[model samples]
Target: MARLRDRLTSLSQPRYLAWRALPLGSFDPRFARLRIRTLVMEWHRTRETPDDKAWCEQTLEALGHEVTPGIWSGEVNGLLWARPRESEARR
Candidate 1:
């Protein structure tokens, strides 16, 4: 896991690899679950709270995603592409 750690560390900094190191995954079910689990754990450790559900919900909303009580997934391209309100868009 040294390689993964090294990669994570290297990409965690403000550099060209930052975006690439975001732990994003694709069609691979195992890797996708792993990335989500790791992100949740890290977020919890850093925040010192296990209330990520709220944060996730808010973020999804801000990103124009439609959140449902029974479905709170973090799938790829899960968030919606928000558009400004009618008045705001016209401004």
Candidate 2:
């Protein structure tokens, strides 16, 4: 698809493979929200700071997400709710 082609052209990398495999809806406008917005797979990479990874958990709490060892769930911006599980510890 054009989107995939565009993405590949912009930056080719292994990480992009996993990113591309995500559901189409995952790219919805919500994912592009301002800093401190909702995130999916990568907690560290989603933090507000451009190069910082420590804000993930703090931001998640602010958004009402509860994190356990391998699971997390809650509403983001009070508009969306999610419950995802991590297969590996500390992922």
| Candidate 1 C-alpha lDDT tens digits along 1-91 | 9999999888766422112233332122232122111122111212332444455455434433444443233422232222333333344
Against the true structure, candidate 2 reaches a TM-score of 0.26
Highest TM-score scorer? 1
lDDT of 2 by residue, 1-91 (tens): 9999998787765433232244532332342232332245443232333422224444444434543322442333112222332332123
Cα distance off (Å), candidate 1, residue 28: 18
Q: Report lDDT (CA) for all predictions.
A: 0.35, 0.37
**What are the root-mean-square deviations of the candidates from the true structure over C-alphas?**
13.0, 13.5
Q: Which ranges in model 1 have alpha carbons more than 4 Å from their true place?
A: 1-47, 71-91
